[model samples]
Every structure is written in C-alpha cells, then in structure tokens.
Target: MHFLTHNTAPCDSTFSPLYSVVFGCILALGLPLNAVSLWTLLRHHSLKSPSAVFMVNLAVSDLLLVVSLPMRVYYYATGTWPLGNLVCNLITMLFHNNIRSSAFFITFISVDRLLAVVYPLRSRHLRTSSNAWKAAALVWLLVLVINIPESMHFSKFLKELNGSSCFPKTPHRSPLHYIQPVLMFSMLAVNMVCTALVSWTLSRRLNDSARVNNKVNVMLIFFLNLVMFIICFLPLSVGILSTNIHVRPLICLASVNCCLDPLLYYFCLDAFWKKKEDVDLPGEQQLKDIRSPCVGLE
Candidate 1:
C-alpha cells in the first residue's frame, strides 16, 4: 500500500475513506469473534488437543491484530497519524506478525489433521498437546525474529513518505521487499500441500460410512483453508512481487481471516461435539435402569 507520494505524483485520497470502512468492519466483526474463540478455547476446551492448541494460538494472534485496529481506524478516519513513529511502527509490526503467525498456525492445524487421518498410529506421538504448544511457541519466536528488520525500519519509511498519515509502504529492493513475498508464498505452498494430503486421505476413507461425518468435517477444514489462501494470502503474496498492484486494500482484506477462522473451530470441533452427544449421561443411564427395573437392583 506504499507509493512514493512525491509532488509529481500525489497519493490517492480516495483510499483513505475506503480503508476507514474496511478497518471499521474488521474491528466490529473480528473483535467479538476472536474474543469468544479465545474464551471457548481456554474455558471449554483444554489446550491438550493439537487442534485446540493451534486454534488458541490463532485466536491469540487475531486478538493482537484486533487490538491494533483502533489505531488504524483512527489513522484512516482522521486521515492523519498524530501518533508517534514508535506507535506507527508497533502497529505495522503487529499487522505483519499476525498475518505470518496466523498463516503458520493454520497450516499447522491442517497438517495436524492430515497426519491424524493418514498415519493415525505414527502421528499419535507427534501430535501430542505438549508438542502442539511447543510448536506454537516456536511460531511466535520465529515471527518476532523474522520481523525485526521491519520493526526497525518501519518508522523510517513513514518518515521518508513525509506525510501526516502513516502506512506501510514497500520500497523496491528493500529488505521487506524481499522478505514478505517469500514468507507469504512459502506459507501458501505449505497450506496447499497440506490441503492436498488431507483431501487424498479423506477421499480414501470416503467409502467408510462409519467415518463419513468425521471425514466430511475434516474436508471442510481443507475447504476453508483453501478459501483463506485464495482470498487473503494469494493476492497479497502475488501483489508484493508486482509493482503494478496497490496492496493496501488486499492487506486490509487479509484481516477477514480472523473472523473466518472461527468457522474452522466449529468444523474441527464437530466430531468432538458429536461424540459428546452420542455418549449417554450417567443420569440417563440410571433412568434407563429404573425404567427397566433390573430384578437384582429392584
């Protein structure tokens, strides 16, 4: 979304209003959705499952982005950045961090499910809750390490633009110029490979009516990740490599991933809920015994 706003070529003013609306909508939807998701993961589900661990990390990443939206909304709405360069850099860092972190966590979840279906016995040790949490920690640590250059140089870019508004601009041949596209495309590739594996495994298991519901639920996970990759990740990744594209809107569009991710939670947990429902409660079992009037118990 960065363009050289020199006197020869003034920045487009129209994008400010559009950005305002987009950020506003993202804040409205993303905030509540992520909050509830975090609560559900922490309160209802123990983070002992690999899926739950990945989801909780995803929710935490989304909340980090969600918290930064207010400043973005203000910047766009007022068409200014009264906030200092430090605040601006922090906001930019959070934005990029969430995008990368979310991508990794989503890919991890896809692979986790794929392994669960494809190599249930072998993957059992690999997919433990402890391993999942360790993976999550590694993702955060790696994201911070990778993004340090961006954090250090972000304010400089804003200062160079010499505008009242502060937005991330990609300068050709810069460090970020190389890093973002590479990272995004890598995540996209991993997601595609994982999705293909999940699909193949599910297809092979499709004939088993006993596991039909479970397979369908897992397939939905692939479908959603594909959708997220297409709509959010693809454009941004490709656009970063091309000078002709204005990437600002696409970056904002990526925020939709936060809201959409909760849908994955629903699908992933479908099997869990089904199993819960299928199990008879102790009280129900007692009532059945009373109704049957077992001779010895009577």
Candidate 2:
C-alpha cells in the first residue's frame, strides 16, 4: 500500500529554501524557550505540580530536538547529508524520539489535569510529584524501547542515488510502519477525549465564582496544550493516513510544538492569572488568606 515511490529523487533545490527557513525558525525559537523552561522549572520549587513535572519532561524532549537541528539545517542548506551514516541515523533517531515522547508527555499532562478536575479529593493523594516522576520515567523508557530499533536501522532506509537522503527510499513494508499510524491515531484519540472531558467538567464548575476562576485557569492551560497537540500533530497524523502525501514538511511543522510548550509554563507555572488578580476581590482575598495557613501549597 505504499503509494509513493521509495526511491524518490533527491529533494529539489526549490524545497531547500523552505526547509532552511523552517529548520532555522525551529532552532531559533525552540532552544531558548526550552532552556528557559528548564531553568524556571528547576529554580522554582513551587512549580513542581504533577502537570508541571510533565512540562519539564516535555521541555527536555524539545531540547533534544533543538540540539539536533543544526545538522538537519546543514543537510538542507547543502542539499545533501555529508555527515555520514552514523550521524544521519542519530539525527533521525532524535526526531523520531522527540515527536512521540512529546506526544506521550502531553497525554500525561492532559490526563493528570482531567483527574484533578474530575476527582478533586482523590487527586490530592493520587497526583504526587513522585508518581509524576515515575510516570515520566516510564514514558521515556517506552519511547526509547519502541524507537531504538527503527533509529538504528535508519541508515538502511537511505539510498545514495543523487545524494544521501535520510528519508526512507524503499517501498518495502514493515511492522513499524504499520504500527506508527495506529499509535499516532491512538494517542490523538486519547488527547481529544481528555480535552473534551476536562473542558466539560470545568464548565460545570462555573457557578462557584471562587472555584470558577481557578477552574477556568486550569482549563485554559489545558486548552492551550490541546490546541498545540492538534496544531503540531494533526497534519502529521493526516499525512500518515493519506500515504500519498510527503510527510517531511508536516513532520517539521510538528516540531514547532516544542516552541509553543513554553506558553504552558507561562500560563501554569507562573500563575499568570493569579498574579494579575492579586487577590483584588474580597472573596478571593479571603480565600487566599484561609488557604495561606495550610501546610501544603497547591
């Protein structure tokens, strides 16, 4: 069912300008955002919520992709991969790992927020930082195990006709190829469900003004995450389903997710709304005063 030829010609020179622009933008934006996110998460001890932990891991995944961009940019700039087989394979591996790992971590963030809103009392005990760390660890392990073989075999996918292209050129079918489409859609389904449920639950709490504001804040944060998920992944997912479409550009577009992730940090970790409100309302002030004496911070 591989409709596209495996050994497609070397990418046209016309495409290199687009690739260079895209890769350059990703590099310029993704690195500093991820770096600042990593720094802020580590420095601010108050930022260690369950969802924040997932954001931290997401930043890590984005940083990996950012670090690998220069080589990709160079390849596009020259219209070839002169970096030899090992570097090419490793770069391909980074791209593969970054996308899936980002998806899984964002999934965790969505579910974590959904549980918090849906089962507030239970979520207090259930959503611990230790558990978040454990979950993040498991995601890394799973992604690495699933991706390592494909990455190691990336060199085999290349053909040296016009020049060495890292993208696969043969029309042969493989289990990984089949599994990828399934995985993309499966994760996408979970994200869409979680987003819908979280939004619905938050909408119901709008009657309680005090809780309403907080719920709205959390809901908006989740909404940002959901929007990013669709913006980054939906096209790639669609391309996978429609096998005739060349997916490399969509893949590059998806990488922009890492850059947008820092927006979540600003919204969630920085307490943007809370700071702006600054306990301006009497009810909010009273609530803050009441909660201020508590042993644990939210």
**What do the candidate models score in CA lDDT, each in turn?**
0.68, 0.65
User: Which residue pairs clash within candidate 2?
Assistant: 6-169
Task: Report the alpha-carbon TM-score of model 2 versus the true structure.
Answer: 0.78
lDDT per residue, candidate 2, 1-298, as tens digits?
A: 2323222435433226577778989999999989988876666544446776787789999999999998777766655666677777677778778878888887787777666655555556667778889999998998888776775455555544333565432232335656765676777778678767756665655445644655555567556666666777666655655546666677787888888878766655433223221211233332233221010123
Q: In model 1, which range of ten residues has the least summed lDDT? A: 289-298
| Error at 190, model 1, angstroms | 3.1
Q: Which parts of model 2 are misplaced by more than 4 Å?
A: 1-15, 46-48, 159-163, 167-174, 206-223, 241-243, 272-297
Worst 10 residues of 2 by lDDT: 289-298
Q: For candidate 1, what is the total of clashing residue pairs? A: 0
Best by TM-score: 1
- Number of clashing pairs per prediction, in order: 0, 1
